[model samples]
Target: MAIPRQQLLVVSEELDEAELAALKFLSLEHIPMRKLETVREAVDFFHVLQEKGMIEAENLSFLKELLYRICRIDLLEAQLGSSREEMESELQLPGRAKVSAYRYLLFQLSEDITEDKLKSFKVFLGKELPKCKLNSKTTMLDVFIEMEKKGILGEDNLSVLKNLCREINVSLLRRIEEYELNLSGREEVLIPEEQKGSTGGPKAQARGQALSVASDSPGHWDESSWLEVYKMTSQPRGVCVILNNHSFAKARAAVPKPKDLKDRPGTHVDAVALRRVFQKLHFTVAEHRDLMADEIRKIVDIYRCKDHKARDCFVCCILSHGKKGIVYGVDGEEVPIQELTTAFTEQNCPSLAGKPKVFFVQACQGNACHKGVTVETDSGQQDSSIETDTRLQLDYIPAEADFLLGMATLQDFISYRSPRRGTWYIQALCQHLEYSCPRGEDILTILTAVNQEVSRKSCNKVEKQMPEPGFTLTKKLIFPVS
Candidate 1:
């Protein structure tokens, strides 16, 4: 049994003497203070953190203001192992940037963040803050506090918040100083009547800039103002091409089915489920069954020629037998994944340039099968593209970014198929997509949940399987909320 526990790690944007003293008083782990210039920089930082542990940090929703400052999805995805869609989903949180900005406003408005002003802020929150499918939670401060409970936030997040505020506006520096000096000695929300106006502090007032965005109720905080930028929402979205290769010619004895696979009935189930899922996403689902490896290339070439200028993304699924780094066709020949992806690379196919191109492969990557190990319970965890060939080098990055490959099982492992249901990976993926997408989840996030779900199932007593998604998506790829 996995023991549920609270772990501590101090995160700070800056830890001056006073903040350092607070750390001593709090008795929490004091992590090194670091600053991020890019999401990749953060990724580097997290990698350093992973040396200490797995670096499985919770979603840093509070720092979205900082992300907005950077607004680089590659960095976010690189650091968090998330897709652009995943981070954007988090960025839209109600108080992502607003709460911190509201604090700055409070410092400036010492006496002006009146109940009336606060109401105006609420109106702003409803309008500017991207509505998370969350339970109407608002503000970075609230999210930060929740993280602190999980021991996810510490001085590091605070330091980052302070730094983010300063980057957003210089006036924040003065407001922060005032906030730290609040005689209350306790962290209290700035009140209008209780605090005297900034009439006594002219220099602070002189440096202060007016906050144009609305904020949380009074001391409450909410969305981005300066750094919150929205990713382009595709006009017609995109289409899904599911190439499910279930049956091979009996004469092609070299491509024999697993003894119990039961004539590929589950694959049909997968095709049906996936079609419905993508159709609900308002995507045109094109299903091609029993294609040869070369034929697969032709289909991608055709898609590349189609006018996808209006589409936001693309999807392709391969359901068949496979080998390491390769999937098999109905003809029993191998198709290197690198070949499948390169067909639509920006260099080869400009139509999908910079757009998310996701490939879902429900084939075994290796002959290894999971011998059911003891299942571990996660107390509260949660959780594309292509190019074409000329024998694309798997060691090299895709010419274009924003591509993803979701593998059914780990490298060299066999993926399980249920005759009554379908492949474990596809079923879990479809189920999780339905459960999470409407909740503002991006593709990567839904896949993570799918990974968690599939990883836990018992294939045959002790046999187990796990699905993992790999991507270089530069932006978030979210299906339209249904």
Candidate 2:
């Protein structure tokens, strides 16, 4: 009746002191399931049993009892903080922050599904299914297959499940089985008193059978769980192209200059800041300082080829004086926004097909800026992308996913810039990112702050304009992980 020395040693070595005491308490005196230390430890203990092939029916029952005990521990923890330590002084497990942290870690660990796969799963859940019900004892595979037939699960569903399994730790999949068994309660049957010892082996075998379930389980999720969703940080790797067509074919051409122009076209802050920020971000930025629309499209096409396999994300920032829907190329040719964005449709760029493709435009969409009401309306901030008359034209493929276009101003407006400094939008954007991007804040949040600061500081400048930010992020993005 003595436990094996190796098993005892393994258990002792693997578990912390509290877990060891809990195990001893369980084995020696049938301690309450709630008396253990951490549910994570309990999970680990169950895993050890599984590895030892000791997952008996009674053990599974023990697991269920333990989980409920832990659930109560969680409830208690939710109600109180370190008070669990006081509970532990009386020999009960504390479940508050401990459980919260575990759940959050679990969700982050489980985020292996692609954004599209997530979308598909949501659609399947929302749609009615006459065939499959949660109450049925159908396998998860069966439910998935049925959904696949009903056009619910796309071709990528298998990959999603595989990735999810990998991310959540395949061991947890087995743990999930034990959790299911824990829900079933004790399984009592007719047995002779003398044969009771024989039951342990069968109980272990039964527990092993309970691992794979068909549907989602509604477990308690706390704020930690919410935080877990932010763990995923995969960003698209699209090419960023900046084309400034405002310059002459020759940098020093004697063209019709704006009335107060001092610096020539090539030395604009828009070009300099664009290059500096993109290079810092480690993007393979391509710049065509004065290319026509065709040349720009040609460069884009080179990167768009899937066979060549360029990158996953795409960005294009155009800097020039422009008419509505058209950015001025070097030769003053009009490059329509639709023409620029069209090169990145799903058909042309399959690698970025469902990935985030961001476009930043700095051009006059129209010509409606009148003389200012007051010459000194400036609040001492730099000028912004000018607001103009013509609206920007955005043509996107109906089904293409994850595209974001950040325009300097609203549609049909000129973006402003100073010859000495950079464009208002670029300067503010860089300033905000340099200062506020390190706090694990979302890109949108930082941009909003940037917009407010820019608006407040520059509303009274001569070319008075406000920087605008627009995005189509499929999910949240936090930059500079370090």
Candidate 3:
């Protein structure tokens, strides 16, 4: 049987001559799975099938093929370089970024889980869970339950999610289905997925059951498949606080001012460059020069009091001298890095709950340097509510989930700065972010690439520096330039 005339007309208009010919032959031959032309076309074709209730057991294989093809197309496009404006407009689509507000609820399920495990779970969500998007409102089991009850999940959505759960531990999914969370605003407006995963007729259900695959391992999914799994919008615009401490004096300053005449705080090369970069990514860059420890906390605290409900995420960068676990203020007083980070937790800063809080620290974690060996193996905070709040001191919570810390250097090594080029870590970071962020890379993946690039560099008389990232994020944090 031919595709409905109306659907065929739309498909023909969208597909080029070659794609149209291929579709016609496939329709005649009754082949279910084959490589398609464009991601845009594949998605459209799938929609037409779902609408017509023609998604059968045969179509499942086609579904897998289409998803993988979409990934390849996306990766190919990312590797291609168009004009800056053209690239941003084309890549950073709205609703593409994932920021789960119910992250606190997810945290409740496993207070004991490690960061590495959290990262793996995030990968599963982004890659395995089809038609599943997370945001600030997902705090309880009811969201999923309610969707199922209301007949919002289609056969295709169920098949994919079931496969996802089977591939992973699925304990997380169970906890989500069983555990209830104590959170404010449990009920919020939700969108209707009428086009795809909405309630289907009995005919569609029969088609889905026939096509169900029993295999547990993720099929046709590999590293390259991630290209379709993650879509970042550079539009998570909000406050980007820069605490650049450049000057210092007697009493052996804690974070010494930049000694490099060209790269020092006064030159503001890193600061300026960072501003341009974040602005390009849609953040409102707020630069604070030479802040004392208390001053830095106070500024971030003030931001905490303001409403971040309108913003998609928060970013704070500290550039200064440092040792072991803290960075020094211009006055030489050290502020515990943990203190700056815990202030934005969901319990502490309700306004930012479920949104990303990103911190990039540019300081030496310790007084040592790194030396790279050949044939290398690679491996890969904010503020406030200080003072009267007394919350952090009592609870001692680390930065909440959805927070990312991209340190300038691995802990305990002095980060290098040139008299002109700027600090090695931030410069490399800024460079990669400029190139990668607009292309829709997740923050950690982007940081990993930055680490790889910086590790190859030699600064401070050929001493090596490495950038490290510490994250409690439960979902992929994509920075698609707005």
Candidate 4:
């Protein structure tokens, strides 16, 4: 049965901006980002949910959960004919809730984060998201939406959230840890019992014999073997393409005065660090410098077209100026980040399908500067100065899996650089890779370390930066150093 329009209208009329935003955030997994962005009112959002088959007259469970999640108990009781206690009991059943525990946890965290920490959180994620998404009026719910769009924050992928919470408030990390533990416990409890074959049949006896023979064989798989990880053991582990755009002479002439990009003097430091690290990890590093937008695409196409059947993975690093959703070419043209990533999809680059395609972008996502929080410590402070790659700029993985995108900073924020030492993000990334990869750590763990390390550092003792990593990998990706 279809839900009556009048009832939806009545409930929609009761929703304010805060409640509406909460509903949208909770519905992110159900509705597409583009469609959700166009929804101007609660009624419109409900319509979209209905269109997606998420809400109906008979299936009002999702709506009830949404109202419950937002703590609109009055609406739940009056409109949905459900109460908070009923929802609590219903949600306790296995797989009963529509909104994931992870999503609910984020919403709860958003509600709990203080205004000052919220400001700090926005600054930390400034470069990984779009400028419009992180304005002065942006809320924690808004930040989580952008993070989901970037594929950084999700039910399964919570490293970025965990890192952010650890930096902002160590206490919050406990919540995530508990959630993970609970998930593990549930998985263990949900394991199915093996089905028995017919008691006195020849087929059943044959099946038992076959099972006995298979178990006796040396090749027989164990329970531990079920936990599969990606194979990163290929020699010269695929191609590592580094598009290092250091000079921007053509950009200065092509772009207007205010948007004129400066030459990245210390980019070579990053290039050298990346080359050394990847070389140590036994990768064939192909470095290109000062490429235009078209040229950048062509270079990626060249790698994408390569027959990478012999390779275990692919890596591409872009170092340049950018704004939200785009990176600037040396000649002042724009390259949509999505274009480069989608080019290597299973349909586009068949040879690299099923293999991890890692992209580490070292560019500004926007022009916002991250303000650092003052820490009270007994140690005396030393004077220091830092330069920022503050030019405003702009996830390629969509249906296709096995991709990781590590951004220098959150969207709309500036990432710092040193004329001599190299950019904070790239340098920290290389350092962590060098240390962690050799110790058998996976790529996600290494990126988390990078996030922690970069978030702790401040330029001029007032400005800070945080790196954001997003991935759709199906298995653990550990680089073999030897």
lDDT of each: 0.50, 0.43, 0.49, 0.71
For model 1, how does the per-residue alpha-carbon lDDT over 1-482 read when each residue is reduced to its tens digit?
32112221213232233323222222122233232212233334434434444233453443333333333344345443456566567656654433343333332332323444334333433322334511333333333333345332342123223333433444644565445434223322210000111122111000111111123222122332223212436644687999887666531454353221113446788898799778767778999988877887788778877877787788888887665577666665667878878877887767778777888888754443222221111000010111122122232225567787887765534566655457767877876664445545466656665664555455223455666576776555567654
Model 1 scores what on Cα lDDT? 0.50
Off by over 4 Å in 2: 1-238, 249-267, 306-312, 372-399, 459-463
RMSD to the true structure for each prediction, in A, is 24.1, 24.4, 22.6, 24.4
For candidate 3, write residues 408-470 as lDDT tens digits. 654434455643445656766776676556555566666765665556544322345666676
Q: Is candidate 2 or candidate 3 better by lDDT?
A: 3
Candidate 2 has a TM-score of 0.43
Q: Candidate 1: which stretches are off by over 4 Å?
A: 1-232, 250-263, 369-399
Q: Indicate the residue-level lDDT of 176 in model 4.
A: 76
lDDT of 3: 0.49
lDDT of 4 by residue, 413-477 (tens): 55666565677788778866765575566776677677766675553444556666777877777
lDDT of 2: 0.43
Could you say which candidate leads in TM-score? Answer: 4
| lDDT string, candidate 2, 1-482, tens digits | 43334443443354464333333233312332343323345445555554544445333323323323333345234322223454445333432212222222223323333445444443444333453342234333333434445533332122223223433446644443343233222221110000111111111000111111111221212322343212223332335677765544432242563221112232256676667666555566778766755776676677666432444456677765554456554554456766667677778766666556667766544333333221111011122333332323343222455666655554433344544444556656655554444434555655564454344333222233444454445555445534
Report backbone clashes per prediction: 36, 24, 11, 18
